[model samples]
Target: MMHQMRAETGPDGATDSVVSWHIVRNADLTALCGKTLSTAAPVQDATRWTLDPDRNCHTCGALFLREAPYFPDEHTD
Candidate 1:
């Protein structure tokens, strides 16, 4: 699964963007699993980890990319 977003501002000065998630199935995983596999929800908090099986056929696996400023800050205490 991939988390994507586009930054935008509303007329009222509300700064926010709609988060979009994308999941692409892997052909190797399909062949291995012998069926179309879907992305399972994260076992733990998303900030900790995500289980995106379609991308990688394993447990507790995820791929994260920081492309834009749409994502929430991870440094806050």
Candidate 2:
């Protein structure tokens, strides 16, 4: 199963741009959307992962659904 996490490209998640959320692979701590995990930001909750449309990175979301085909909180055959 693929693990997930949330991240941003801005410090303390404070950006004046349109994008805010970026999806990350907790296993390797890499972003599927090719975005920087903002490791330089203040300490953050690494477990703040979500698939909410309002905060999801569309690019990462699409890649995630295509690669895993199952939600982390769901059971699949």
The number of the candidate with the highest lDDT is: 2
**Candidate lDDT values, in order:** 0.28, 0.55
Model 2 stretches with alpha carbons more than 4 Å out: 12-19, 40-51, 72-77
Candidate 1 lDDT over 1-77, as tens digits, reads 33221112223322332122232232122312233222232212333323343333232123233322233665567
lDDT of 2 by residue, 1-77 (tens): 44555446443354433355555665444578787665543223323445246866778778876766654455645
lDDT of 1: 0.28
- The collision pairs in model 2 are none
RMSD of 2: 4.8
Off by over 4 Å in 1: 1-36, 39-45, 50-63, 68-73
